[model samples]
Target chain A: MDIRRLRYFVAVAEARSVGKAAERLRMAQPPLSVQIRKLESEIGAPLFRRGTRGMDLTEAGQALLARASEALALAADGIEAARAVAAGSRGRLSVGYMFVLANAMLPRLIPELRRSIPGVDLDFAELSASTREARLLDRSVTVALCMPAIHHPEIQVARIGAQPFMLAMPIRSPFARLGSVPMARLQGRPLIALPPPERDPSSSAVAALLRRHQIVMPIASRVETVHSAMSLVLAGEGFGILPACARLGAPRGIVFRPLRDATDSIDIAVCWRRDSHSPLIRTFLKCAEKAVAPL
Target chain B: MDIRRLRYFVAVAEARSVGKAAERLRMAQPPLSVQIRKLESEIGAPLFRRGTRGMDLTEAGQALLARASEALALAADGIEAARAVAAGSRGRLSVGYMFVLANAMLPRLIPELRRSIPGVDLDFAELSASTREARLLDRSVTVALCMPAIHHPEIQVARIGAQPFMLAMPIRSPFARLGSVPMARLQGRPLIALPPPERDPSSSAVAALLRRHQIVMPIASRVETVHSAMSLVLAGEGFGILPACARLGAPRGIVFRPLRDATDSIDIAVCWRRDSHSPLIRTFLKCAEKAVAPL
Candidate 1:
C-alpha cells in the first residue's frame, strides 16, 4: 500500500517467514505480523498462509508481490535518477562485464566514466553474454560491456570492437611451432573449452563454431572462471580458443594465434536500455563509443 | 569507514554533486563534504576529484564504488536475514519474477507456497532474469520463479515444470482453420518471436527451434510483450511462439498448437543462492519443491 509497507512486504515475501521478515526489517514479530495483516486487510485479501512447517503466499499475496517489486525498483530507480539529476554528474550505474574481458576493458572505461560522470557511482557485476542481455532489458544496469549485438528489443547495442578468436596453445606445442594448425587438422583433436555447464560466452561460441565444422563435440574441461581456464592452457592442459582481447593480461607460456578462417571472430558491444533516461548513462555510452571507435 | 559514511559516499558517487547528495541524504552540504573527506582520509586516498563540471572518482574511488555496493547489499541482506529468523512462520519473502510469467504463474504458485510454508508474507517484483540472478547471488531474494537452469556458479536451480512452448496463430490465418498446422510447414513461414537478444532460455529455445526448421528469421513485426504480441496475432498479425502454460486470457479468436517435437519446451525453475545460510530460505526451498513437484 505504502512504500514502507511495500518494503516490509518485500522483506517478508523474500524471507518467506514472518519472524524472519520481522528480524530483517529490524522490528518485532508481532508488529510485523500486524502490519502484514493490515496490508492484507487494506487489500481485502489474504497475503499469506502459515502452518507448523513454514509460510507461503496466498493468491492475493502473489499478485501484490509483483506490483510491490516493480514499485520498489522504480522507487529505487526514481531516487537514484533524482539524485543523479541533482548532482549534475553523479549517479549509481549498475555495470555488467564478462569476466574474460573485465581486465582488458574495464581498466580503460572505468577511469573515463569516473572522470566524465564524476558523481556517478557504479555498481559492478560480472555476467556472461546471456545474462548481460537479460540485464540490459531489465534496466538492472545503466550500461553493459559485453559481446557485440545480442539483439534484444529492449536494449540498444553499440559496437565496441571486434576481436578475432585465437587458439591459445602452449608455447612449445606442435601447433605453435607450425604458426597455426589448419582448422581441418585440428578436427577430432582433444581441445579444452569451458564446458556449457559453466555458461561462458566463449564456450558457447566455441561450441557453435565446432558444430558448424561438423564436429559432434570436443573433449571439454570445466573451469569455473576465465582466469582458471587460461591458467590451465598455460599449464598445457589443452588448447583454448580465447578472444584476442581477453589475452591482454595473458599469463606466461601461452601464445595466441589467428584461425585460418577469420570467421571465428567475436565483436564486443556496449549495451544499455533503449529507454534509459539517465544523462550520466547517456554520457558514458558516448564515452564508451569513442574509447573503442578506432579499434 | 562507517556504514553511514559509505552510504554518503554512495550517494555522492551517484549524485556526483555534493549539494544533491546532501539533499538526498537530508543533511547540509558542508557536513556531507566533510564526511566524504573524512572517509577519504581514513581510506588514505582522495576518493573524488572536485571540478567545475562535477565530482569524479579517482582510481581509489572507482575501487571503493564496487566494494561499497557489495557492502551495502550485504548490510541490507544482514537485516533481512535477522528478520527472517525472528518472524518464524509469519514473515515476508521478497519474490522476483520475469515480467510476463509473473502474471500467469505467480497467481497459482503464491498460494501453493503459502499453503506449504504458512504464515508467510509475499512481496513481489517483476525482475529481469539477470537482476534476479544478481540479487539471488547477493541474497537480496530468498527465492525466485524464473526460467530454469541458469548457469551461475553461485546460484542453485530447481526445475519446477516444463512451460510448453506453443505456436499462436492469428484468427484470420489459413492455419487457424485447421486448429493446428503441420509444425514443419509453419517452419520458414514469417514468424514473430520475443526478441531474445538476451540469450534468454525462452528466446533461445524459440530461435533454436526456428533454426532447426531452417525457418527464415521471422519478420519481427515488433518487439512487444507477450500479451500484446498475442493480441496482435489475434488481430491477424504474424504467428508467435508462447509458453503453453502462460495465461494469455485471450479471446477465442486465437489458436495454439503444441510443437511437433515434444522436446521443444521452456522450463520453469525456482532459483536461490546456493551459499545462503538462512534457515528460512532452506525451509522455503523445501516447501516450494513439494508444491511444484507434481507440475
Candidate 2:
C-alpha cells in the first residue's frame, strides 16, 4: 500500500468517522472516504463496516492497522536517521594521531569534541610516519593530527599549532645545566634521530634546519619513532632533537631544553582527504584548531 | 533531503555531466542544473568546483554523494520490505498445535507452509488444552490447531478435519477381540478422562454425549492432557476415550478400537484471533484445509 493511503486509513480508524478524520487532516471528508475505499480494494478486503452507531473495523482492518502503523513508523525513523547523518550531528569519526602527540592532543581534543559534536562516536588510531597519509586517503581515519605536515596532491593540510624543536639530553650532562643550548654548540654532537619518512625525505627537514645553523651531528643511532629517541637520550647514548610536545611524558632522566638559536619549529597540523566533504571532518577541523591554539 | 532529489543527484554524479544525466533521467538539462544548484544552496556548500574536467566533485559534494545514495537505497528497501510483509510473503508466523495434534498435524502442515510462503519465519508452540485459547488471543501464536473447536466471542475457528472417538485399552481386553466396540459396553466402565478446560467445561461435553446412550463412566482418574490419558490406558489402569488420530505413535501395550454406534467425532479446528488480517494466517488456513482433507 502507498504510505499516503496508509496514513489516511490510520486517521479514519482512529477517528472512527471520515468527517472527524477530515477535520483533523484539514481536508474534505469525501476524498478521505474515497482513499479508504481505494485501500480496501487494494488489499481485497473490507476494512470497515457501518455499525448502528458509526464506522467499525473488520477483522482484516484490525490486522492491517498494527502493521500499517509499524511501516509508517519505520519510514519516519529512516528519514530522521539520514537527516542526523547529513547534518553531521550523528555519525562515527575516526581520528588518527602520531603516537608522540596522543597524550598532548587527545587530552585537550577529546574535551573539545564532547563540547561540540557530542552525538558522534569517536575511534582513535596511532599513525606512524608512514601510515598517516595512506590511512587518510583510504578513509581508515577521518582526520589526522601530525607534525611537520605531510605533502601530497590528494591530501589537504591545515596548520593548527606549532612548537619549536627541543634538545633532549641526560639530566647529568653539562648541556642540561646550560638551561638553553645555542644551535652552534651542538656541532659534532652524537644524536639519536628519527629516520626519513618512508616515501618522502622532506619531513626530515629538521636536519636541513640544523644545517642552516652550521651544526653537523653524527647519527648515534636511528629510530622509527620519537619515543625511541627519548629512550636513547635517557640511556645517555646521545642527545636527541624532538618536538617540544614530546616533553609531555619524557623519561625522568631525560631533560628537554629549548634550542635558543633555532628559528624553525615543528608544525602541528590537521589533515584529511581532499575530496571529502564530511560534516564531521569539518566540525573536527574546527575543534582541532581550538584544541592546540595555545601551543 | 527528499528521496526524489537524491535520485537526481546520484544520476548526475555517475553521468558526470548534466546534459547526459538529463538524457538518462528523461528531463531537460536546464531543470536538472537548477535542481543541482538548489541542493548545493540547501547544503550551504559548493558541491562542484569547475575544472578542465567535466563536473568535478568538491570535498562537500563527495561526502553528500555517499550519504544521499545510501538514503535513497534504504528508502527503496524499506518500501519493498513493507510490501512483502503486507502481501504475506515475508515475516514471522508462530503456529500453535496441541501436543496430541503435533504428530498428526505439523508433519503435513509444515510442508504446506514451506511451499506456500517460503520467506516467512515460523515458530511452533505446543499448547496444552488450557493455553491454546489464551495464546491465540494474546498473539503469542498466530494460529492454533485445536480439538473440538474452542468457542469464544473473540476467536474464529474453522473445522478442517474430524475423527470418531476410539477406545484405548490393554491389548488383552476381551473387547480387543470384537471388530469394533459398542457404545453400550462402555456403560459403568472405569474411565480415564481429560480434565475440563480452565474457564469452560463444555469440551467435557463428551461425558454428556455418553449420557445420551445410558453410559455413566465412573471416573477412574482425571488427567491434564490426551497424552497422559494414553499413558494410563497403556498401563492398564483404566480404559480411555481418545480420537482415532491418537492411534498414531501409541504405546505397544494399548489397542485402539472405534465406537460402532457413535454419531459424534472430535473436530480438528484451526483458530486465530478474530481481529487478525494476516495474509500468512490466511495462507496457513488454506494449507490446513488441504492437509487433513483425506481424514
lDDT of 1 by residue, A1-295 (tens): 2456667877888899989988877889998888887866665545676757557765446555665565456445433443444344554778887777777777777887778877667788887744777777766666788764566677788776877778887788888877655677667666676545234554577777776776643565766556677888888777787778767768888888777764777778877877665556667777677666545
Per-residue lDDT for A154-235 in model 2, tens only? 9999988888899999999899898799988898889998977555555476787776887789889999889999999999
Off by over 4 Å in 1: A1-88, A128-140, A148-153, A195-204, A211-217, A222-224, B1-295
Task: Name the candidate that leads on DockQ.
Answer: 2
> Candidate 1: which docking quality band?
incorrect
Score chain B of each candidate by TM-score.
Answer: 0.60, 0.90
Kindly list the per-residue Cα lDDT of model 1 for residues B1-295, writing each as its tens digit. 2556767888999999899999998889999999998877666546677879779765447556765655565445433433433434545677777666665666666777777657677677776644667777665676777764566778888776777777787666777666455567775566665656354544477777777766664575755466677877777768878787544555578877766664677877777777544355666666556655554
**lDDT per residue (tens digit) for residues B1-295 in model 2:** 3445557777988888888889999999999989988876666666666545568665455566775566455545544554566678877788998877777777888999899999888898889887788898878898999886888899999888897888999899899988899999988888998876556555465776687787888889999888889899878778988888888858887899988788778889999988777788789999998888766
**Candidate fnat values, all:** 0.00, 0.00
Leading candidate by lDDT: 2
Q: What is the interface RMSD of candidate 2, in Å?
A: 6.4
TM-scores for chain A, candidates in order?
0.60, 0.90
